[model samples]
Target: MSWTTPSDVVALLRKRWDAGAYLGRPWEPVAVPLRGPRPGELADRFGEAQDWVRRWEQVDLVRLERVRTGGRVIGTNEIPRRVWIDTFEGLCALLRVGPAARRFEHLLELTGRRFPALTGWVTAHPMKTLEAADDWERLLAVVRWIETCPPGLYLRQVDVPGVDTKFVERHRGILTELLELRVDPVDGVPRTDFAGRFRFRRKPDYVRFRMLDGSRIGGFGELTVRAEEFLAPPARRIFVLENEVTYLALPETPGAAAILGGGYGVGVLERMDWPAEVELVYWGDIDTHGFAILDRFRRRFPHVRSVLMDQDTLLAHRVHWMTEPKPTRQPLGALTAEESALYRDLISDVYGPAVRLEQERVRFSAVRRALGP
Candidate 1:
């Protein structure tokens, strides 16, 4: 009959409730205009219209405004024109979301009572509050513990009764938001780095290298040490390669050490105090990003040299060349003329689109020759 039904009114309120509109604030009486049958339909389909009216009349949780209308079947009749839900309780009852709404209200109450500053956060993130409702108590306890504890403790050292590192890790996203409301954010720490943002001790960066002079640090020839604790080995030559296999397979040189380079993470080298006159050489895939990493590394160690990354090496291994999935095309200021030209050719697809020649793909004999006797 083109008239609004009781279900229609409930559906509209349900959408508003799910959107978190009515949960954050007290409900005010909201009157929704009802769509009624046209005058012609009121007379033509009197019985169906009456049944529709009967549905609205049966609904007791809402008030219905009526208008006098006349038709051939009746001299005058009161027809519903609008439905008004006068209370939050009435709206929840009509929408059947009472339990979930009550839970959110409890969360609001607890958050307001304990952490008044986070009350707005609860209102803005009602759904998030509900999702974390089961863990809200423990989450609050963790925040309280962090508030009283000294800074610089690791996540494992967060000594809440039931909260563990895994729990904090799992809830770091929400915790970061809540903690920011209470704690002062540390400078130079990105918000995404939850530990750093909250002043927690972060895991240390490690550098892995092997002493090729057959010398061992204590016992192990290859060792991974904290970047800040790494002491430069007494070697005249340092060979850095992105491929771990290539770094490991390097034949013993008289006074050379091999470092497993972590792509663009060559900045770790800056943590070490390199000795004077030690030649630093990097060998990476003959691709744009490889040259980019070499460029970034050379920015710090301007005297660093690159091996097996020239046009000769790339052309010699044409059979092993593959397409770079995502090639970097940015200009590299630290590259030599030859390296710059080769980098240009790679980005411009001189040989083929996005060409790449991995260091491991080069013949070991060729790598050995590059290393020199």
Candidate 2:
């Protein structure tokens, strides 16, 4: 029916709770806009419409307000015009979530008392607060610890009674939001890295580099050292390949190191000070993401050179071209003129359909040739 059902009226109020309306303000007389039948609609489905109105009147969730109407078939009638949600308690009962609303009220009271600053956060994310009801106390404790203690202690040093380092790490995302309100930029922490942002000792970001001169590098032929340790040694001419086998198989070049990582989550590299100094040469697939990675890497190190990601390499491996399922079409600001041109071709369906030349599929000889002796 076109008229609002009891379920539909309940759904309207439920959306407000979903959007964190419960946390915003103390309960006031609130109303759900009753989109019931117009007078003409009432005339068409008179009996069915009366039953729909009766259902709203019977429901305890909402009080139906009506208006006296003059009609042709029915001499005079009172029709439900609006729905009123009288109180927050009624709202909870209507939604069948009384316990959750009580939990949020407790969190609000606690946040206001301990961290007056986070009251805004409480109001902003009531739905999240209720969702994390079980762990909300611990989340607040982590926030209090950061605010109370000096901002430079490692995350491990956080001495919350029950919560451990993994707990903080597990909830870094929500913690970042809570902690930001407490900690200022005077503390040396990056929001991108949770541990560093709150001055907690963090697990080192591994740099898997194959030593072209295994004898000189003083480690295994293929080594995945911490970024800090990688910086300890002087590195020159690092070849960061996207493909794993290709990174592992590259021939020894007197002063070169082959680097690789899964996916394009390269945020870990932001922690290191070494890739900035060394001559970085990237060889990725001839695709949009490959170019996007190259583009981002260049943003960090403008001097970083891209190898084997050219139109020529793509054309040479025409028979091996595979479709890039999802192509990134955003204009890459950091790509060089040539790299940007090739990226354009790859995304625009210029060279066959969704054409891509993966670095792994590139001939071994071509790779060796690119890494010229």
Candidate 3:
């Protein structure tokens, strides 16, 4: 009963097409073995077997191979043993993907004419090429612009006919693939970084800070500046607080300032050059991740110290304790002995299961005391 049906043949052809096998290699006659009724099946259901053979006779797209079966009930009759699609056109016609196949061929022509180097990509991703058939020309235009345009320009500055920043953003994945084939990647730029790989000017990272000493820079109490342009304020102590509210609510301390640390994004701070004599202090949640952030910050600024991330601070605020959800167990190389001990306890669940005490929950008086005269 499980004989190869017409729909099964079509599915097999489509599977090959979907795999890009048909597009990549030279067209050859494809022969699919047909599962005909066995001798027992022929003897038991001779009329039903005859009807199945008649079904294949109706389908003209494939050339059928008929083999005689020696049977007992019915005289030996021919049944379709194999179905052969003699040409690629016949295969496409049977699959009813003729229009899509023609569009893919057109894409091949266009890619060969304009970007000959990307011919392999066209063949390898025939379906993808067909999917983008409407916007194929515009996608190529973006690539052409990228090739000839001056370096260091933002993606927004890419001027091409019928192509905007949104189009580029939408098609960035495909563009990255195509561009990688044509453009030499920038040194030190990871392949996953779309902007860096193509040398486009990326969005600037901004660092936000508040002057705790009442000292005004451009007469502003709080300021956000591009990381590259960030210059240290006139302060002997810099308190990097993970919570924005804590950074904002800090009592004014003479010759001290606070920066809103961006958790793991503290890597951006490495771009700025801080004064050597300035004391850098970090205050974050008394959790494994908080210690991890401090450890990362200390990697760039070795002299950095942590405040209010101690065992005593965590124990005092037991009422504010919450589950960390996911605790980092990685050994913090830069943590001081006390910080490391606390980090170990948090990871080991010594206090409680994934215990965490957010910096914002700490008493204001304790925060004031931490910033002692």
lDDT of each: 0.87, 0.79, 0.86
Per-residue lDDT value at 279 in model 1: 93
| TM-scores, each model vs. reference | 0.81, 0.75, 0.87
Top candidate, metric TM-score: 3
Write model 3 residue lDDT over 1-373, tens digit each, in one string: 7988888888888898887777755888999999989888988887888889999999978999989885666778889999999998898888888888888888899999999999999888877887788999999888888988878989889888788889988888889889888888798888678787888999999889888878899899889999888887788898888887888899999888888886876878866667346899888898889998999888888999888988899899999999997888888899999999988888889988999999999999999999866
* lDDT of candidate 2 over 1-373, digit per residue (tens): 7677888867877787788776567778887666777777678878887898778778886778888774887668888888887877788888998887777889899889877898898888888777777888888887887777874567788888889888887887888888788776335556778866666566656877667766455545666777666563344787777788887788878777777855574555656667788888888888888888888878887888998999889889999999999988988999988988888888789988888889999999998898966
- Could you tell me the lDDT of residue 348 within candidate 1? 88
Ranking by TM-score: 3, 1, 2
After best superposition, candidate 2 residue 78: deviation in angstroms?
A: 3.9
Q: What's the C-alpha lDDT at position 292 in model 3?
A: 89
Estimate the overall C-alpha local distance difference test score of candidate 1: 0.87
- RMSD in Å for model 3: 2.9
